[model samples]
Target chain A: MNEVMSLLKNHRSIRKYSDRPVGREQVEEIVAAAQMASSSSNVQAYSVIAVTEQAGKDKLAELCGNQGYISECPVFLVWCADLSRLKAAAERHLPAGAETYESSVENFIVATVDAALAAQNGAVAAESMGLGIVYIGGIRNRSQEVAELLSLPQLVYPVFGMCVGYPDQEPGLRPRLPLEAVLHWEGYDAERSESGVKAYDETMVKYLRERTGGMKDTPWSVLMAEKLAQPARLHMREFLQRRGFGLK
Target chain B: MNEVMSLLKNHRSIRKYSDRPVGREQVEEIVAAAQMASSSSNVQAYSVIAVTEQAGKDKLAELCGNQGYISECPVFLVWCADLSRLKAAAERHLPAGAETYESSVENFIVATVDAALAAQNGAVAAESMGLGIVYIGGIRNRSQEVAELLSLPQLVYPVFGMCVGYPDQEPGLRPRLPLEAVLHWEGYDAERSESGVKAYDETMVKYLRERTGGMKDTPWSVLMAEKLAQPARLHMREFLQRRGFGLK
Candidate 1:
């Protein structure tokens, strides 16, 4: 692997942070790099909010399922799929009779993809600078509350959050599905996935056992089974609808 | 900025590619780097189909709005939001009478986000190896046909496709929104976006005039206005539903 690939493969989500602060200049640099990520048709329908104040982070930490690292990190960034800016621009530029489809499901997907692409770039940029980062999906646990806390406008939803700071603790790299399991050639290969995942289940079994001191030796499939049987963020659909996003 | 940030910032969508072929080993390296990207709780709900055969590429190219570059590129990758693997795993591990939420809207978002994050990493890794990439959102233009062509299984849908090869043309970097326009401090700043976009409108006007030799001097916002007025891939919701993704 090359140096850039090494940086990418070395990624680990940091949940513990040192007291070192992330300078605003550093944040700006990271954001600038993120802004350059591919946007669908250059709509750039995303916005990031850097929460540095103690109270703001504290509230966000609570909102994000009380992930205290959000509070401990020097910066907690809320990555939002924002269509309001596009809506505003469309209103400004379109002829008076033009109806806008800014909130269509397709645009929603575009905005979400744009936000994720930008966030990943920012994550890589921060890692290159010795900064550690963790994505907080719990930002969506109470999406409505998070929106209220950040005073987000209609048609803008927080997709995820990232906690950035110097690493105080190192975490092991999580094993992913085998390359064959995820990468197919020419067309879909359903046969490959079954065996690859069966093998991966064994690998993950050993990993979980070692990581948890043999207390949690359940196979990865079982863990995944438990996860799948449980509903997560069921409010998401309703919340997006209320935010003026078109799903139908 | 460091080398990695420089690479990230230097990104421009490559629409044209030379005849140089991308080796299988190179694609593996890129996939390996992409596999290391963060997944939602390590669910890793995504897959990639690497289409290298000319016939396969031609079919996909037609499916993706006849983008000639899809056929010309050495490799056309279909990145998929996949829940089928997780569902299979759940079925294997769960006891009888257990229901899975694998097709929920939440899982749909997670899968889509996972696919996008991985694709971005793959793009960067490829770029590091002196390759170029262009994301094809048109993969969803005729998503059902695309899915049929790839023989995609239930709960597996192509989020986007990417063309990868050596650049045959030098496209100037498209200017992005001002950093302040996308970055807010502590909360969403609606006021800042207005002025920032106004300034960026002027910037984009000049860029479009120069890029098209004064043939298309339209402002970025106006282009966005037209985009918003046109419904794109309205079949996405239904297609995803047919593929067993639950939006409700």
Candidate 2:
């Protein structure tokens, strides 16, 4: 594989960061690369909030399940699925249709996908620059608080957060489901999927055992089964609705 | 910037592709890179379906609002926000809790984000290999039909499709919202956002006029205003619920 492909394949989440500060110029360049990502209908419905101040990082870290690395990392970014700008544009240029800009599930999906695409580009760019990065999805655990902390307006939701800085430690790449389990042919294949899952269970059982030094040697199936069965962020639907999304 | 950064910044939607076939080996490598992308809580709630047969592509293109390039591209891959495997895994390991794994909007968001991250990695890898790609969001316009065509199971929605091949055209990199418009410091800077939007509208007016060969010219605000005011896939809520998502 080439350098770019190698970069894509060797991704590992970084939770420990050195004291070295990430330059503002580097962050700008990375965000510029993120802006080049594809958007639904070119409606780049996403915004990123960069937090470098210790106070803000401290608050964000607390809000995001108290992830200390969020405060330790030199730069923390919150990627938001933002439709507020579109609403502003609509009101300014087409006042008659402003109210119609109310968010729907589809629009929410678009925004979420756009945010993820752009954020992934930012992650790749940061990693390519020899910086460490980790996605902070726990931010959703307190979505309302994170939004208030970020001063996000209606129609803008903090989808996830990221930490970027010089790596203080090296981590092994986390194993993923086998490609056969995740990639189908022209259609969904039930039998192939079942078999793939059985194989992947074995793979993950070994991986988790090794990664956790045999203290947590649970099979992947058991983990996912338990995780999926539990309600995650049960208040999310109401939270999104109150934030002017998916109400349609 | 390095090669990866350059590739990220120079991204352009490739709607035209040459007749050369994409090697299966090359695709597997690309997908291996894709599998390296981060997933929410390591759930990996997504899957990809690769369509290479002419007949399959034709049907997919038709399902995706008659996007001809989807059929013309040497490889078209559908990225799915899939929880079916999780459901299966849950059933096999915890049958009593299987039904509780029914989808919620938060889970849907996780799936969408996971799919986008994986798809972006695949796109970057494909571009690194001198191939081109364009994301097809229109697949959602007729999501049920598309799902049926792909034999997608419940809890597995086709989030988007991607067309990949050797590029037959070199389009200019599309203009994006100004960096200041999308990147906020600490929290959102409302004043800066308004000003940035004003500036970007001017930039997009020139870009749109030039890209369309002067046949049409409209400010970014105007286009976004009109598009955002209209209902897009208004039936999506019911559709998702029917597909075993957003039921919560």
- Candidate 1 chain B — worst ten consecutive residues by lDDT sum? B99-108
Highest TM-score scorer: 1
Instruction: Tell how far residue A130 is off in model 1, in angstroms.
Output: 0.4
Residues A142-220, model 2: lDDT tens digits: 9998899889999999999999999999888777777788888788887887788888889888888888889987888
User: What tens digits encode model 1's per-residue C-alpha lDDT throughout B1-248?
Assistant: 57898899899999898878899999999999999989999988999999999999999899889899999999999999998888988788786989878767788889999999999999999999999999999999999998988999999999999999999888989999998899999999999987889889999999989989999888878888888888888888888888999786
Considering every candidate listed, which one attains the maximal lDDT? 1
Return the TM-score for chain B, candidate 1. Answer: 0.98
Worst 10 residues of 2 chain B by lDDT: B96-105
TM-score of each: 0.98, 0.98
Candidate 2 runs further than 4 Å off: A97-101, B97-101
DockQ (C-alpha based) per candidate is 0.87, 0.79
What is candidate 2's lDDT per residue for B1-248, written digit by digit as tens?
A: 79999999899999998878899887888788988988888888898999999999999898888999998999899999989888887888888525564577778888889999999999999999999999999889899888898899999898899999999999988789899999999999877887988999888888878889888788887888889888888877888888999546
